[model samples]
Target: MQPSIMLLLLLPLLLFSAPSISTAQDFDFFYFVLQWPGSYCDTKQSCCYPTAGKPAADFGIHGLWPNYADGSYPSNCDSGNAYDASQIGDLMGSMRSKWPSLACPSGDGSTFWRHEWEKHGTCSESVLDQHAYFQAALRLRSQVNLLQILQNAGIRPDGGFYSVRGISSAIRSGIGFEPGVECNVDDAGNRQLYQVYVCVDATGKRLIECPVLPTSKCSSRVEFPPF
Candidate 1:
């Protein structure tokens, strides 16, 4: 599991746009994973990557942001006991380096604590501008689930998990691949549990399902989280 601070750091990154991915349908890995409406795949790249990247496996926090480093992941090509814990460590360090001012750090500015700007408090407009930055950070931390799933499934050059995406209500209701599921053990010795789903919609924003509470909308237009 990621430390609470690192997860907080990624909030801003979720609020913004990620780099574009080429989804030409011929020999493109993305072709196997992304699902979208209509022929829009030719022009719109928003829902292409993050949505496609889901279901490859139940990556932990990485499930939130699949477009990291141009979308080719498990760059080390090692998995299982063969996996490198050091690489995961490197990812943590690298993320902090890329966005130091974000909420990945402990204390103050933590995502667990709402920003004064979010609260419309004493902070000025300039401070409020930072909210976009925090949202992006949140999105990235949410992708941790992808990394865990990749490692758990031993994804590699010779063999790896395969993910496919489609918007059919039938598909979503079937027993096929699930994009945003995460694994977590209960502290009280209960069985592991499946967390919410995370994904980007056609509008490129984030969404979450509380089931009991109303779905919380994120800054990006089409993103959605695990239910």
Candidate 2:
């Protein structure tokens, strides 16, 4: 056999056997983020309800993102494993309700989910495979009633502005840990309650106090926009 032919034939085998590149898998905690649907839709870019129809009038799962204690995070840790919705087929009903996508162009929530899994979920694959990751987030979402928590604290999302600290206190009262409240400006430039970041153990179970939080751009009061 010619040397070139031998090299060409052996190339496929070498490529197939190449070592998988290592990614930063170790992480300190998770930001089990829940987003307000109304705030999400009221932004300048706007949003589209899922093809599964409108989600419930409540906070929904944004992601279960892995992060370092220093506030740094990991992402795209598994290029080899893309999000296969079939892996989480059984969780669709819950996902459609608890994690609906409101981004354009319109979608059934898969694109949003795929972006989350690939960017955030993949970093935690060492602990939870795709199915477990999605399931665990749903479980966490079920455990906390964010809307009820705020309402109980007299912070209704009736397009009324409320103290940011008070909102955090309400969540801590309900869930036993203070949460990080993030806000965004609406189309009319009103700062609205956007996402609530709660920390979780590395295993994606049980909420914990956040080690670091997204810089809160909220004022003394932020609008809890109506859905």
Candidate 3:
């Protein structure tokens, strides 16, 4: 075979074998964080419901954060790619249901959603656009069913304190992977359950082992305050 022909034949193999390169903003996984409304309200003194009114007795979506395998993450990746509430029209209903803002002076959840989108969603642009990013979080929330899992484990949010082991076990049993549990101290100095963060693959489609286990100040027993 001619040298030139040999080189041409090997070109495709060389290209295929080369390692894929990614930019700094690229991420490897997602942290789907769900916050407990009761805990948030208890800590914040007051809570504001969306214009649609108070959310149901369920964990609200804090954000779907993009994380790297190295335990680092990117934020505000694209300053130009600002959040636009109008783009997420169809998702508004679900967002209100599963991801309502419990911050003060709510009514419009857009501000909170915008912050999440701009800060975290932009970092995931390589895999998900604005709409898909929000939708993925909603879908993950529905799929995880954290409330149902805890309830089935006799861990209702009735202002009862639950063992961190029990809480983690319930989630692991329900979702097939251990999740990170976080807590906060209310005004009364009670250690209350705050958030549950489950790691998802970069595609935001499937759960994966967390690259770095989440650390929490939550003790062996954490309160599951009622909303």
**Evaluated with lDDT, which candidate comes out highest?**
2
RMSD of each: 23.0, 7.9, 3.1
Q: Give lDDT tens digits, candidate 1, residues 1-227.
A: 67898778887686553433332221111101211111111122322322112222222221222222233322221122232224234343433332222122232222322332133211212221233323443454443233334334432212212232221122234323334332222233222222334433212233322122112221111212221
Error of 3 at 32 (Å): 0.6
The deviation in Å at residue 112 for candidate 1 is: 8.0
Provide the lowest-lDDT 10-residue window in model 2. 16-25
Cα-based lDDT for every prediction:
0.27, 0.91, 0.89
lDDT of 3 by residue, 96-151 (tens): 88899987786678889989999999999988999999989989987989999999
Give the Cα error of residue 221 in candidate 1, in Å.
Answer: 33
TM-score of each predicted structure versus truth? 0.22, 0.88, 0.90
Residue ranges of candidate 1 with Cα displaced over 4 Å: 1-64, 68-106, 109-179, 201-203, 206-227
Backbone clash pairs for candidate 2 read none
Ranking by lDDT: 2, 3, 1
Between candidates 1 and 2, the TM-score winner: 2
Model 2 C-alpha lDDT per residue in residues 52-161, reported as the tens digit of each score? 77888999999999999999999899998999999999999898899999887778999999999999989998889999999999999999889998988899889999
